[model samples]
Target: MREVAIVAFGQSDHVRDSAQTSEVEMLMPVLHDVLRRTGLRTRDIGFTCSGSSDYLAGRAFSFTMALDGVGAWPPISESHVETDGAWALYEAWVKLLTGEADTALVYAYGKSSPGDLREVLTRQLDPYYLAPLWPDSVALAALQAQALIDAGRTDEAELAAIADRDRTAAAAHPHAQRRGPRPAGEYVVAPLRTGDCPPIGDGAAAVILAAGDTARRLAAAQGRRPAWIRGLDHRIEAHSLGVRDLTDSPSTRLAAERAGVFRRPVDTAELHAPFTSQEVVLRDALALDDTVRINPSGGAQAANPVMATGLIRLGEAADRIQRGDSDRALAHATSGPCLQQNLVAVLEGEA
Candidate 1:
């Protein structure tokens, strides 16, 4: 496989709603910023892939319309996923490894405020059983939280502390939607408070991936180190929530192992645990120690923009490495109810 590195990343200001802005409008700035930072023009990109959902846009082929932001006039090799942008990044990496593309542009965006996001997410559940019940995202996450409590994996106070810490860290992130200190509020769903759940937001993010010498040149021009992808893998579990253990994430553990997360010491991790209790499960699954810094950019708990949130985790971890803040890091992304699917990537700075 070819060595791949994230050379540039850019994101929009995460907000509760973008009633005045279209998805294309939200993406243009981020896309331009990423391309500009890499000193690459749209014509120079070998491949372009995006992540977005027509369900959120309330129309079919919504991503096709978003192509305007990337300027598809000259006709570029493009693809898209209905999943998070982190998965899109994985696809781009695969393309580079195949020697079909040496440089790729990846982006993801979501507008969750247009509809009842909690209700909308329930559609992703098992159609025969869980979908009929129409359990909102918060309620489903609360069920997982309660399971953790019952299994003695975590407590309410610990969950609150996690929420408190994440919100505090979010204060420094200009693009973070939720910031400042937050008192764990009354349960929106039993065992899950307002703070325990992620704030629904609208946002977009873009990343530029370059292989080998191109990556080195980009990093040098930017006067920073490249965050080389050491290992990358994803795994999925049973779709039926009833058959799965909510307090443990076997999928994450498998993905982490495949991604070489435990092969060496990690200095930081950016995890896509939207719910506070889910963070506890992921930490155990990844076997992260107290010495490893977690979610310094606040994580999805502070500002989750659905399809784009997972990609933000990867970008944040890479940014930390590029800035010389950490030598090695782990970036994780999750999908489906109770983390049924997971992607893990291990990144290391220049040796």
Candidate 2:
């Protein structure tokens, strides 16, 4: 595979609602900002990809409408996914590896406030067994949290501590929807408190990638370091939550191994764990220790925008390396209910 690096990242301010802003309106500035930061124009990009959901938009081909924001007038090679933006990044990386594109742009957004997000998420589950039950996203996650508690792997207090730490860290992120730690309270769902859950929000994130020499030149011209992609891999588990071990993330473990996460010590990790319990599962799956900082941007629990949350994890991890704050970092993204799918990427800065 050809070497690829993240050259620029941009995000919209996360909020519970964007009452007046259309999806294109929400995306335009973010798309422009990333291009501006990279000192590149839309025409310079060899490929463009995006991630979004029709369910969230309450319309089909919602991503097609977003193309207007990118100025598709001149016509650009683009593709989109129904999954998280991180997966879209994966697709762009593959294009680079094939030598089809030297530079690619990836972005994802979620305007979840327009509809019932819980009900919308249920559409992704098995229609016969899970969808008919309408368990909602939080309830499904609560089941996993309960299983972890019952197995003695974690407890409510520990979960609360994780929330406290993440929310506190979010206080520094201007784009985060929720910030400041509060005491964990009575369960929203058994064994899961409000703090244990992510704040539902509307947001967007974009990342720019360049392969090999293009990456080096871009970094030099921008006077910034590039987060080189050393390893990237993804894995999936059984779709049925009942058949899987809720407390252990075998898929995440496998992806981490394939992504070479344990090859060297990492200074930081930005995990797309929407819930506190999920964070615990990921930390163990990745074999990260106390020495490694986790979720310095507060993670999804602080501000989750569904499709965009996972990509934000990649952006946050890369930002740390680009800023010279860390030499090695790990970014994780997840999809499907109860952590059924996971993507892991290891990034390193120039020595």
Q: lDDT by residue for model 2 over 36-106, one digit each (tens)?
A: 98888999999999999999989998888899988787788999999999999999999998999999999
> Can you write out model 1's per-residue Cα lDDT over 216-311, one digit (the tens) per residue?
998888998888999999999887888899999999999999999998989999999989999999999999999999999999976899999999
TM-score of 1: 0.99
Model 2 lDDT, residue 100, Cα: 98
lDDT of 1 at 242: 85
Worst 10 residues of 2 by lDDT: 182-191
Per-prediction TM-score: 0.99, 0.98
Error of 1 at 84 (Å): 0.6
* lDDT to native, each model: 0.92, 0.92
